[model samples]
Target chain A: MKNNKNTVDPFENEPDFLAQFDKKTPFSVPDHYFESLPEVINDKILKKKSLKFGFDKMSYRILGPSAALIALFFVVFHFYNTPSGNTVQPEEFSDALLNEVSVELDDYMIYDVYAEIIEETESSTEQTSGNETENDEYIDYLLENDIDINTIIEEL
Target chain B: MEHYSDDQLLSMFAARESANYAFNLIVRKYQERLYWHIRRMVIDHDDADDVLQNTFIKAWKGLDNFKNESQLYTWLYRIATNETITFLNKKRKRFLISFHDVEGELTGSLEQDHHFSGKEIELKLQKAILTLPEKQRLVFNMKYYDDMKYEDMSQILNTSVGALKASYHHAVKKIEEYFKNH
Candidate 1:
């Protein structure tokens, strides 16, 4: 018997064996689809970053003007309400002088009380020192007037 | 003219003011391969299109960091695979479907889809593949469809070769059994 296995061609018998899968190619992608991808992506990233940077810069810029305006408004408002260049009238001057007089009177009262306390303390201290000095002078006179008691007793 | 490697092409694009030529070359080289890889995973043309664009965009942005340790195609494949998987995961999350149920639903959809060329056969095959656990399905796809060596697959997937072999064998047996039963 001739080898029947050798006679049979595996490929010949199954012409359409792999046909179902034949249509399936290595899934191909379209051409040049990603060529512009980098530019698109870079543009997006750069635009986003730039927008954020610009917004930050603009906010600081806006704040600079706003802060300056606020400061200027404050200064202008202060100066506008301020009494300057002989703006005080006679009545205002009189009212201010009255307030100054009251303040001076209060200061004078405080000084008067302080002076009285200081004078009283000084007089008391002087009296005490005078008495001490008198005692010292008497002691000195007694010492000078005293003869030698031992010599007198010996003579007796 | 000598064909430029992916790294070479990318460098040319980076250096040249008009990188369209080099970039176009990269697209031509990778598009078909990436499309099919994503198409098989996402199973929708529109989803595949979005993922493909995202993959290339990511590649373009990350090309500066690409060290050329692996082949450029492999690196792109990694990105494409990750994007497809991430898209599927997000879709599943949006749909509030369990991961297990997502596979079942995808299989059912494949079976009913008319857009697939070999609808019945491909659906049957896909359904059988869907029956596999996620890792096994990944292994089977890489091994059976992409014809990737286990060593390369291990490198791409960061799995042990032994583990991948077992997963592939299990997937193949399960699929063969499914075909037998059906």
Candidate 2:
């Protein structure tokens, strides 16, 4: 059998249409560009984080004093508005008047006159009882004590 | 065996007075991902570096206020997206360019950058993407490049899943057309 194989030089017969595009423009990054990037970034981030953390800690510390001052202010405000225990009641009007009069009338004659009037008022109420015999027993007790009946009657 | 989730790390960082471990762990985990994401958006390495630093700093400060409604990565993504957009908006203002015009400028710059590998291919793709509106480009990046599901993307972008799907499909058709033409 005769050898009838055809041979072709792949690079020879082609047009140079893509020759300009075949020239490679290499992309070169700086040496250790990405390798040192992490450390640089870490340093920057560390500095930023420290400044932020410092400010936050300062604010946190300030919160304690701020809260204390607010609580103290509220306590003082409450105390200033609260009423004292010694305020007089409406039902004690007559008692107040009597106490005032007693304080003003400290003389022995005034005291004697008030005491005689009270004694006469008590005897008159006793005499109005339904039984005359009970009134007689009260009169007997007053007589035995030698009480001043005219003085008490004059006062009444 | 006791690997901490992002939420747990954040909570530990917030609650403890000395949580360098937690904070450092977060930095180690997310730095490259965030860096690349911001780099793609901003189109400048130095700008991406600044934005990445600001992002992590903001994350550390705002960690306590983060509710666990979304995953921690998604929350961070939302922040990063907002930051990148805001930075671009400011840059646009400074250059007196509209957002679409800014994307055109970025595409031109990226196409000419010598350090980008597969520059021609990536430029073709980026130019095609630049033809899209801002929101559509963002959607395409998240879906096509990042392979983010619509659910996670919805949480990050605050857009409806249906709208994202439409945006992504439109972006794909536009890119396909560009490829066919070029």
Candidate 3:
């Protein structure tokens, strides 16, 4: 290697002097240190995950029982649903939602629900063939029941 | 086990199920290289260990944001280098000392540490290298000791290759002068 007149090539010009520095270190690690590091790092990851998910926070831990108690309250209220004609009771609101989203139902659940509705409608239709009576019955029934008539009609 | 490419290892890391496994492989593969990279700077086993651990932990946290803009090794080397520099900076601040003061302390540590069994000449080279400014010492270590290319050092240091070449050139001249004068 030709060194420029003003420059010194310490590493290049030495007779294999640089060989000592290659991947060799005087630093020491504790015995089996590398073997244990993965576990240590994984533990750190687990802690990070817990923190990220808010699992370690009081809010999340409180959420578990509070959410359950709220659910229980709703379940108890549903069986004893209130009779409010104008205001939407929670139970009625939930039923309406379930019915709307039930559009994803398979053949059996839909058939079971529609079979009962159709039978009652057919039996009642025998009383009046005029559009006025049928329309009035369906619309009034739906309005009083707090059901969205359009949603059921669209689903069908 | 078959060796996985950097991309393949990264994909494995992306998966939650295999992330730990891939990380273990990564640690095993890169730990020694990173340790020495750090050890050369800190010159003490305990300090090097701390710096190396912090480097990997930081790398683990930053892995998601890694865009493969450079080689995986270079990214890791960059992290390790930065961590070493940060460790040294903290020591300097805490001790209320200058960069040269820190270098002098390191020189004392090197002589006293029982683990360093290098010959007097090797020790002289280390001290000479240490006398350079921290940035030049880093450049010299990577280029001279690691035999790293100027391009790779540029990626790791975020400096231009031309600048790295110049830095290496100047570092060598200083070290050679140290050897002659000492």
Q: Pick by DockQ: which candidate is best?
A: 3
Clashing pairs in 1: A27-B32, A28-B32, A29-B31, A29-B32
Shift in Å, residue B143, candidate 1: 1.7
lDDT of 2 by residue, A36-90 (tens): 8767777887787689898888778987789889999999999977655653332
Task: List the candidate numbers ranked by lDDT, top first.
Answer: 3, 2, 1
TM-scores, all models, native as reference: 0.57, 0.58, 0.64
DockQ of each: 0.04, 0.14, 0.15
Q: Give model 1's clash tally.
A: 4
lDDT of each: 0.67, 0.68, 0.76
Q: Indicate the residue-level lDDT of B60 in model 3.
A: 88
| Candidate 1 structure quality by residue, lDDT tens digits, B1-182 | 35788768978888757465666667667776787777777666667878887887787667767786887787888898889889989989999999888888777666655456564676677777788877788777777677777777777778888788777766777887888899
lDDT of 3 by residue, A1-156 (tens): 775864864434433434544334444566787787667766777787788778647566887789899999998898578565555433444466567643333333333344456556677757545644655565556556655434555665
Winner by lDDT between candidate 3 and candidate 1: 3
Model 3 chain B poorest 10 in a row by lDDT: B113-122
**Cα misplacement distance, residue B116 of candidate 1 (Å):** 0.5
Considering chain A alone, what is the TM-score of candidate 2?
A: 0.25
**Positional deviation of residue A121's Cα in model 2 after best superposition, in angstroms:** 99
Compare the candidates by TM-score and give the number of the best one: 3
Global Cα RMSD, each model: 21.6, 19.6, 16.9
Q: Over all chains combined, what TM-score does candidate 3 have?
A: 0.64
Question: Candidate 2 regions off by >4 Å?
Answer: A1-28, A46-156, B1-3
